[model samples]
Target: MPHKNLKQTGFDEMNLSPDVFAVLQTVGYEIPTPIQTLTIPRMIECKDLLGQARTGTGKTAAFALPLLSRINLENKRPQVLVVTPTRELAIQVAQSFNDYGAKMKGLNVLAVYGGQSYSVQLNQLKRGAHVIVGTPGRLMDHMRRKTLCLADLTGLVLDEADEMLQMGFIDDVEWILSQIPQPTQIALFSATMPAPIQKIAGKYLKNPEKVIIRQESDVTNTIHQKFLMVKNINKSDALVRILEASFHDGVIVFTRTRNDTMTLTKILEEKGFKTEALNGEIAQAARERTVNRLKNGSIDILVATDVAARGLDVDRISHVINYDMPSKIDPYIHRIGRTGRAGRTGEAILFVQPKEKWMLKQIEKATLRKIEEIALPSNREINEKRMDDFKNKIYQTIGTEDLCVFTDLVESTAKEQDISISQVAAALAKMLQGNTPFLPETMAHKSAAKKKGTKAEIKAKSPVAPKQKQTPARLTPNKIAPTEKGMERYRIEVGHKHGLKPGDVVGAISNESGLESKFIGAINIDYDYSLVDLPFGMPKNIFNLLKMTWVKSQKMSISKYAC
Candidate 1:
């Protein structure tokens, strides 16, 4: 099918069985992704298929559904073999098959990989498994020992083919493919089509139909990318500030090491964020529980290393924060790809140190987009946000909860103490606040003050005439000129005084308003406020939200520019 026509097809229209359609409905899958829409029909027709797609594109279901549909329950002797690069992926693929084939009786699926007990796999294989998902190395071992028989295998899949090649498992993959008997349909999926992966496809696949959904260096344009320059000592503080200043439903913070995951998790928890940690040190069961917690909204933040977070698919991940930048561009892409998935908009924030600016450039070059640099939120901003959140909580409780008992207690306490009821309530609130201060000291004050002084110097050197409109020539070197036609100029109450930069303004407005960065026009930062160009005819509600939004250390207070 043509790409455009395929994009219009839904999962139900892809010739899926009623049982599979029921399962898809139960799992709340309404539409098909690009890869799924094109690959599923070809796989269902028993044709060899090759797909090029990135992570988080719903590729697992694209292959799993067709494999499950082709399974024969009566003869369960490993009819399908799925080879992946990592154990986590193996387990995830096995779980997808199980979840999608929940109603299929006597359909057994097994995941075999290293670090797992051999006895468990042996017993499961002996009992009979309709499908096997495994890593290349372990699957090769099983095949050599005659524990896993490919004699009855009717289908084969090499998932993450490029990743397997990078891990030096291409030889093993080829050996395993050579072992599979004739007449078995093959499906190979990779994020990138390197020459090595292409060689494998040419050698093994028979008249394979190609489906390229996305390129590896490509990121969803819906994701707003931003970065912060922070010192190593101040990373924790900066992270807290960003979390407080931005609104998100579920967040994943990536760290470089396992120990960092635990450390950050503890710190975030102490700071009153609902957080969890996923690392290699944790048991598999605990990791599963942590992931489940994230999915169910029991926790809002997850701190994890790259290895531990592989094959993680959660639709609610609204933001991805790179606390420590990855060493390579592929991992960086994979990390942020966790969000901005399934056509939903998301945001990614990177914390870059002065020394790592080169690495930031590498990422930007690879992704083919500029990573907007944003200032760290000042202490005043964090305090105001916390106060607003606390007040909102109280208001929500009053509107949705029964407070008669609390009101009576307050009234009685007021009468007994010979004070007003309002005083009693104030005392109760103070007691509830405990020893924690409502506002903490501003940590970024020195930098903010220095920026303010610099802004004053610039203003004195080149002052704007009183009550005159600021033109493009009046903008500083750090500002972007308003070049788009029909752009409406709006002023926000945050600028050099608040340590605000042009990119900081762009990031905040784009993320909070769900406006694409392309639509966010030029930015002009001044001493105590900034001017930005945006598309005209914005909705009243969105304009109000933009007004109330917080940037560096103050509310945007957004308004149309008069001059």
Candidate 2:
């Protein structure tokens, strides 16, 4: 976010404490992001602020540095509370606080969120934390149980308020805001200011200083975005082909549901990948371990849901594969933003179904870039890549490791078998390959299609399924059809009155029913209920489960809606 033309320079100009400045210097944060440059000073002065900044624009550090600078490490009774939309962001913000305040003694920052152990949070609360970071639900739960004492809380941050609004946490956030003491300094950061967000700012934030940052379009310039058209059933095969053929330092494969993350992780592992799964359900310690593994080269691939991968920043991740496309454009941006960090080039590949092409267009329009259509990696390509990798592996081993014993064995074996040394070496390589062949068979069909031309090949390999019986479209008196081709509308019992948002319904249905986001269609919210379009042939078991799935403490009570 740093502007090259801006005259203002380092954190020193902001008159930050030496302790905070030293910690920043140690972390190599020489230049301030635009949000940080503007918001830090106001936060330090204990003034209410409203900052409009994107997630990756260093907003966390903007608020964290100033808050830590003014933190009373002696008292340690929840002096600052930061509420985020998701557990991943909460953990990230808490980590930022700890990293920046490392020089300060007796600094205890606690991150509490749903799916985490309440007993652990209670224990942490009893020990008295100087700062608390958590999601709205978990924070409200703790506050309701009288475990989180906010009487001494001096500073508060509502980070990503728009996300909270979109996730249907606005009511809970407002309740939390109403409970905070009148004198508490508040700072709210949101990427966009919708009417609801603006209303909240006017109501809860008093005389707030405003900092608006324009959205940067150049973030994705270094990332090559491409889309592969594939059937839902063929995604795994395509993914395997892509992984085998594409060169990447590290890859994050994005899936819609947590279960998909686990399922995909196992599949990749079975195929001999150093892979791990990250989701909301993963324990905090385990999540941190998985992320650290990805960071330290212990794991070369990560399969994660949108919520789990929210605050992820791994510079070594050279590729982001959207195994299942997101329903929203914002999430698509956030997912790809994980890569191309530190000015390194990256790639984002999306798997698109026939029905999801409209959403792809929406994403293209939102990002102001055309996502080039790319064919799935052919078997011949995979084989070539495998051969190259095998040769490289042998070369690296010869250069780095001692092969004297193996060389002698190969030589002796060749002499004993009356065979050439080359044959013996080839046999050893075959033995090393074992069940996994180094060079897989090339696709004869693909080669034939290619001979006919690129367009012909695409048509031949098109993901459209063979003609099958279609479900009769059900019509009511209103005579409305589902917005998309293969989706059917259904009613959910929670809506605007319950502070429902389209994302909440999508997330709930996907999480509870294991339906991928791309399968979800248009969502319309009403007063006390919402209508959503889902894939027409949802399994009965999933339907039954979703009928009782809870969102906002209310049962979904899903039923077919003719609208």
Candidate 3:
């Protein structure tokens, strides 16, 4: 049985900031899809969100938009932090923040990973990024440098969190989360929720709000989808232009979920366009009839959910618009494949925000095709396209024989109203609109109004002072002196207040400081610094390397324990 899939519908009702809302409208986003509807409010209220949604259900925006809303542009340190499994995902998540936040002034996002240079990571942290999106390992590196501090953190998001745990990054994540203030709001989004992950959530998150988007809402491979990379803000304005330029017989806007679908549908309808809703909650019989109507040309656009729109055997689906970008690489392949089938090159259009550039890159990576980033169609361009389309509709309507009576009526009305035939055509345009205007008011370009750049340029933050290389002296029992080898005793800055046992000190220093696990002869955690034994009488070079390493939360400089 198909679950009642919800479509993303409207924004006027939500509590999102105007700057964020303006970005959404330009990108053609409607109401909150199910995840957005449920998650957006909670995200704004600073509550922990435990969301259960599949790959393509609009989960990214649900979190990104709200999380970004909390970021203080003036606050220097990382206020919003997201931990993902891999470098690619970390990079993608960072892009999402930039896309939704294109209108938010002074918002900078950086992606951190192991392969990236440490000096580079230090630079970005120092450059005053408002949000930090990174893999656990690199983020841990920042914590050690004290370049990226969490004391002022407002939100901590763990995206695709289960995958991080499965990949042996849970320990790193837990350690990082612990360093953050206990009052931080945490949001965890994963496709499959495992017990271990839930346990971690239970242990860390404050009373969380949980919501799951059904699977059918995800893009189906049987259908085709394609997205465009545009160099501007206000993807929604671009979408309107594209719709006018292209010939789509019937369109179902696949948003992240119900709220998005409804929101988009209402906005389109308000634009005096003929649009209707189709989703999982609608009966199957109604769903089939809707598709049939589209096939027979009774309806030109049916905004529906992926679940409800499935099994739609309509070959006339000339276009599939991805109003919201897909998160994973696979769905993109599936959505674009919906068109250009049966020997026809069907069109697929995606409205990408400034942040969605990475998502576009991933789609290209998956499909092995380079999607061109086109310029936003101007209002003049859209008007011309609409005129061309209207002319085509007229030619097609004239080719059919069923308009005899309507034509006579138009002729008589023209004569009675004492208007020229051209004026009558204009009058019909006004009449068809009736109470609703056919040509919706042209929305202004939003990304242009934004103070932030249309594209986010990746830049290095600041250099963390590399841990000073210690000159190893001779071994002094209680004191740390530079010797031939590294320091005989590893120096620690934390003590009992850190709740660390001797084994904890031993394990952390050994693992991070890179000294042999067995060679850590003695660990004495006193009032301030701890002394850990190591191989002595080596070289000064290795000792210098050890100085750059870090233990649990402290950097192990090769020095004597300071009382």
Using lDDT as the measure, which candidate wins?
Answer: 1
**TM-scores of all models?**
0.72, 0.72, 0.42
Error of 2 at 530 (Å): 43
- Tens digits of lDDT, candidate 1, 1-563: 23544446788777776677889999899978778888999999999998888887878999988888878899979999999887777887899999999888898999998766688899999999998999988899999999998888888999988878877899999999988999999999987788999999999999999988744324456688999988755898888889987778899999999878877887887778999888766545446667888999999999989878876778899999999989998788788988988778899999999999999999889787799999888777788888788889899999999999988888888899899987877777779888776667654555676767776687888857779676654434354564478789898987776668778888778766778998988788887778899998888867876776655435689999886
- Tell me the spans in candidate 1 whose CA falls farther than 4 Å from its real position: 1-7, 215-219, 231-233, 395-404, 442-563
How close to the true structure is residue 535 of candidate 1, measured as C-alpha lDDT? Answer: 92
Predictions: Cα RMSD each: 21.3, 14.3, 27.7
Please tell me which model should have the higher TM-score, number 2 or number 3. Answer: 2
Q: Tell me model 3's lDDT, rounded to 2 decimals.
A: 0.67
Off by over 4 Å in 3: 1-9, 220-563
Tell me the tens digit of each residue's lDDT in model 2 across 1-563. Answer: 33335456579888787888999899898888777788888888889999886655678889999888888878969999999988777887898899999999899999999766678888888998999999999999889999999999889999888888878999999999999986999999887788999999999888999887664524576689999999655788789889999988899999989778877877787788898888766555557778888989999999999878877877699999999989887788778978875446789999999999999999888777899999877777888888888889989999999989988898899889999999987877878879775656556546865687788677788898889999965322223344788778898888776667778887777766667898788887777877888887888867876886655535689999863
> With candidate 1 superimposed using the best TM-score fit, by how many Å does residue 313's alpha carbon deviate from the native?
1.4
Reference-based lDDT, residue 226, model 2: 97
Q: Model 2 lDDT vs. the true structure?
A: 0.83
Say which prediction, candidate 1 or candidate 2, comes out ahead on lDDT: 1
Q: Compose the digit string of candidate 3's lDDT tens values, residues 356-466.
A: 887777776645456655565566776667768778788998897598788788899889988887888887777765874344444333543354434433123344567
